[model samples]
Target: MDASTFFILVLIGSAAACLLGSLTGLGGGAVLTPLLVLVLGVDLRYAIGASLIAVIATSSGATATFAREGFTNIRVGVVLEVATVAGALLGAYIAGLVDKSTIAIVFSIALFWSAWATLRGAPPVVPTGESDALATRLRLASSHPTHGGSQPYGVVRVPSGLALMFGAGVLSALAGIGSGVIKVLAMDRVMRLPFKVSTTTSNFMIGVTAAASVGVYLHRGQIEPRICAPVVLGGLVGSMVGARLLPRLRTRWLRVIFAIVVIGAGVEMCRKAIVGGF
Candidate 1:
């Protein structure tokens, strides 16, 4: 397509991603990546680079609201950032030596894995939950304001959570995705944090986690200025609006539909990978 049309697409797409991120705490990665490559005819490598930049922009835009409203736990985010970012750097470095198709195939599998995990519908809440000694000592857990009474949640397997975060970072950097899906899964399942806390905390850490990848993408000349400028600007604005509208739209149906979208996108990506479209 023409330059103007491509720029317009990036703006609109990024705005949508911001909305998704604001509403469900994810955006620009799963949805935008394929669209850029398939519809816009951009190279997958370039699409991934730009999408990773968009993830950083999206998270940076949302961090303030999440923190101000007490939705994000800063200490936990900071602690996890160390592992994730380090992993991202290593993944980015490794990817440079690998074929883009290989990276694409791996990315697609990761997406499917995340979608299936999310589809399990957040397993039953733990009863009489207990935290491991490390979780208790670090105070890495807290209670959130639920519909009825504010219920408390605890985290366990602190070391496991960090290990997963490291793995998530590697995947994200390799794929130019936000890696929030894996991050949340680690905290919610292994760490045993509540859904809200795990999601918000994952959101809190994404920007920091992406920094390592962002630098690598830039240095590798994968990011196009024409794409990044409009997408970033538009995403920043869209995320602000999404954050404001999220509370009002918190309904069961909305969440269910969102999950379906994730699953569909995830499966499509996996199909492409298997077919050697990577």
Candidate 2:
């Protein structure tokens, strides 16, 4: 494709990915990377770099709304970010040594896993009754606004959650996706936070996680301004629109549709890897 055509397509594709991501609470990077590599014929590294930029843009944009709505648990996000940032730096270094095909295969596996998890639906948020002493001391336990008022929730298994967040960060740097799936799983399931709180907190942390590796990608010259500029702008705009529309949309249907898309992307990535096209 010509430069102008490629730019337009990237803009549109990134916007669509961000819209779907915002609606599904998945973040734009998950969809954007595969779309760029598989459909647009972009190099995996460049695609990942652009997707990371889009992830930071979309996450930062949505985080403002979530925070204002009292859905984000800032304290929890901040505490977990220490682990994530550390892991992200390490993962970025590892990415430099890993083969593109290996990265593609791992990314595809992660996509499939995410699809399966999403398809299974978000498990009911069950409070563990027991709270982490560290969480209590850090005041990570918090409340989020509900229709009636606000409901309080406790944080559990803090160490486990922190470990998982580290893994999430590793995946984020390696695949150039937000790895929100892992973040939400850690907070919502392992830590036993409210669903809304977990999702928003995951969104809150994603930008920082991406930013950590983004510097590495930039230094490596993988982040191209020509590609990242439109992707980031389009992703931000689309995520804003999606966030506005989220309350009115049927999220169950959105999850189903997006799950199919994720599965398709995973299959395509695997095919490319097998064909030596990674």
Candidate 3:
């Protein structure tokens, strides 16, 4: 395809992917990576590099909106970022050693797990009016604006959450995605934060995680400016729009969209892996 046609397709694809990504906290990389490799016939490593750019852009575009609306937990995001960043560096280092098909398989598995976790649905959490001592000491407890007014929430299982974040970062580097699904699982399921708070916080954290891995990709000569530029531009636009739509969406709808998008991408990756794309 010609340069202009490739750019247009990438722009459209990244925009759609980021729209759902910003809403579900998956980040655009999950979908965009597969689209680039499978549909656009880009090399896997190059797709990963471009996807990282999109993930960073999506985070930057959506995070400010979420923070302004009081959905993001900055305290939580900052704390977990330490582990994620560390893991991202390690994962990026390992990515150079692994073959492309292996990366594809691992990426698909992670996506399926993310889909199952969100689709299974968790019970509604009612605030117990008590906060964990560790969380309280760390000032992790916070509130978000709800239809009824401000609703307060508490944090729990800090150690477990941090461990999961580290894993999330590693997978993110391997998959060339933001690892937002695992981040959301850590905060929403393990940390016991509200769903919206978890998603927004995941958005805030993924950008930093992606940035860490991006350096490794850069040194390896995987990042193509031509591919990354349009993808980032489109992702920024889509993420901003998705961020605006999140406040009005119900939790159930978000979960449904998250599961659907993740599963579709996972299936596509699996197909490419079986076909030996590398």
Pitting candidate 2 against candidate 3, the one with the higher TM-score is 2
TM-score leader: 2
lDDT by residue for model 3 over 77-174, one digit each (tens)?
Answer: 99999999999999999999999989989988977876776567654765444568898999999998899999888899899999999999999999
lDDT of 2 at 141: 80
Sort the predicted structures by TM-score, highest score first: 2, 3, 1
**Residue-wise C-alpha lDDT for candidate 1, range 97-215, written one tens digit per residue:** 99866877777676666555544556676622677899889887677776787777777888998999999999999988887888988888788787778888898788777778888
Candidate with maximal lDDT: 2
**Which residue pairs collide in model 1, if any?**
none
User: Compared with the true structure, what per-residue lDDT tens digits does model 2 show for residues 115-184?
Assistant: 8877787787776545678888988887777788877788888999999999999999998989989999
Stretches > 4 Å off in candidate 2 = 128-130
Error of 2 at 141 (Å): 1.5
Ranking according to lDDT, highest score first: 2, 3, 1
